[model samples]
Target chain A: MESHYFPIVYLFGNENLAVNLSNILMITVSMAIVFFVCFFMARKISMYPTGAQNALEYLVQFIKNIISSNMDWKQGKHFVMLGLTIILYVFVANMAGIPFELATQDHVVWWKSPTSDPILTISLAIMVIVLTHVYGIKMRGLKEYGKDYFRPAPFLAPFKVLEDLANTLTLGMRLFGNVYAKEVLMLMLVALGTSSLMWGIFAFLPTIIWQAFGVFIGSLQAFIFCMLTMVYMAHKVSADH
Target chain B: MSIFAIPYVRMNDKEANPLIQEFTWLDAIYQLAAFAVLLLLLKKFAFGPIMGMMEKREKHIADQISSAEKNREETEKQLAEQRRLIEEARREAKEIVENSRKMSSQQADEVLASAKQEAERIKETALAEIYQEKTQAINALREQVSTLSVLVASKIIEKEMDEKEQEKLIQETLKEVGEEL
Candidate 1:
């Protein structure tokens, strides 16, 4: 068995229902940052956008394009906020731990990306999948939504269930794995540098290079997450499917 | 493996397996709630007003464009109307000029005809006056000749002579009258 300490807090003195304090803190911080930035950008809305307004409009347009590409405007228009929230939250979470990490000597992590944990990402994935189903039923009616599983052939129903499972796992794990690996490599590099004076000098360049690469990966993942989200949404809501 | 074999830090001390093995329900719930709240707040404050403003701007521009087109068409129509009026005025002026020219020429012809008739009347009166004077002169000349002949006959009767004397008396009277007349 392998174990690592975390800053855990039990709810109602139950071990099974414990919460990781670090994850919660990071999640809150990410949410706060996303909310404030969006709020400030949208505060003084103008017809001819300038400065932050331009950037905000550009982000809206970018997300709009993503949605439109996946589905028509009528169905796609509803998901713009959902897409924006996801991208902003994920991107902020991904970039959070890259600048610095906080951990105790005894392996108790106080600060890291919220998305670095599988529980958070998987939870988000589950929520997204559930929302898709809800929208599917709402837009196409429960009967039609159920009929989609048996379409092209009845035997394909089992495979469709499996595909949903696969989609949730991949969506959650993909984000978790990439962010986790990047942080791990960054920590390892820092550890290697601190191991000796000679290694410290050599590890400096690679650490900087890795950090730069991490930025690119974080942004790309954010975009991919948004894109896949709209695609899933299109699958659920659109009539042509 | 050898590189990670540091003295103070054990390989197993790192928190690697906890990521998969540990699952926390509270953390997930907290994150989901936070995300949901953020989405709701952002939708109300950010996306709603921005989208409304954009649509408003688009409609305003469309209205302006349509109004401008309408104004342009109106201007063109007025311009054409003005041009037609000017053309009508010019035609009327030309018609006025043509009537005046015809009137002046007609008056000139009438004046010339009246003057010629007046000149002809004057000439005819002058010729008639000269003929009357000539006729009067001829009558006076005939009367003088008759009186002269009567006087000569009276003088010859007074002489009272035979045929041979009478012829001599008449010859003498003719010589005397020739000398005197």
Candidate 2:
């Protein structure tokens, strides 16, 4: 049997019943950090924005541009809050594990990228899918919204349902897979550094180079994740989709 | 052998670590709750007010531009009205000057005519008074000459002839003298 050294769980006790408590703690802390930064930036709004306020306005306009590009502002304006939340949360979560990681007394990792797990990403995907349905139903009456499932023929309803499931699954799994792979590769590089004396000669340079590349990949993943969420939402809300 | 070695697409048996096996429902619930809380906080504090401020600023700029245009229009109207008033005042002043000039000229002509009439009346009165005085003086001189001739005749008759003849001559002479005068 193959064996691995890393513990997915940071710590375990009778008091903790939640699955993978380490990831949960990381997620909670990341959420709190995101909320505090957002609150501080959003504290003072003015007619003429300056400094931090200007940065905040820039973000608002950027999100507005994204929404308007995909669909009309009339229909897309309602999703601004969701877009901001997703982009900020995902970006922060992506880079959270990059700086430095901590280890617990039990030799398990206490800090890592929360998005690397399937549970959190899948939950987010499900929430997005459910919200799209809610918005579709609200915008188009029940009779009209239900008509999309039977388009082109009545026998294709099951396929359309399958399509929805596939879309959600892929959306969640894409993030989880990419982040998990990045973690594995970084771990391999670290292992290469410590495993052999000859390997140590080239290990430090490649590890540093890979870390920089990881930063780029992390940012790209956050952008793609947010972009896909908006696109999926557009399909549900807009008539052209 | 594979397309870019995608993670989920490939069956990597070595990755079947015990810790990465199963997904729990509780974590999903927790994630949902966490996201929901995030959405609520951001919606309340961040997105709503920021967007509102933007709209408000846009409206304020539009209002300022329109009001400035209105003020310019009002100033132009007032300027036109003032120009008209000034033109009217100038016209009135010219009319007043022209009327006064006409009145003064007419008054001078009247004064010249009245002075000419007064001089003619004075000359005519002096001529009438001089004729009247000449007539009175001639009548008085004639009466004195007749009286003197009668006295001389009476003296000569008393010295040379009778009284009746002398009286007849004096009457006839007095008659002739009166006719001639």
Against the unseen true structure, what C-alpha lDDT does each candidate score?
A: 0.83, 0.75
DockQ of each: 0.28, 0.19
A-chain TM-score of every model: 0.96, 0.87
RMSD to the hidden true structure, all candidates: 8.7, 8.4
Residue-by-residue lDDT tens digits, candidate 1, B56-153: 87898999999999999999999999999999999999999999999999989989988888888887887787777766765564456445654666
Which candidate should be chosen as best, given lDDT against the real structure? 1
Interface Cα RMSD for all candidates?
Answer: 8.9, 10.5
Cα lDDT tens digits, model 2, A1-241, are 1233233221132223335555667778888888888788878878888776777778878777778878878888888888888877877887787765565554456687888778788888888888888998888768778988888789999999998898899988988887777776777787787789878877989888878877888888877777787887887788766
Tens digits of per-residue lDDT, candidate 1, A106-215, equal 77777888889989998998888888899999988999999899987999999999989988899999999999899888888988888899999999999999999989
Candidate 1: list runs displaced more than 4 Å.
A1-4, B1-16, B97-181
Look at candidate 2 and give me any clashing residue pairs: none
Off by more than 4 A, model 2: A1-18, A104-107, A152-159, A193-209, B1-15, B83-181
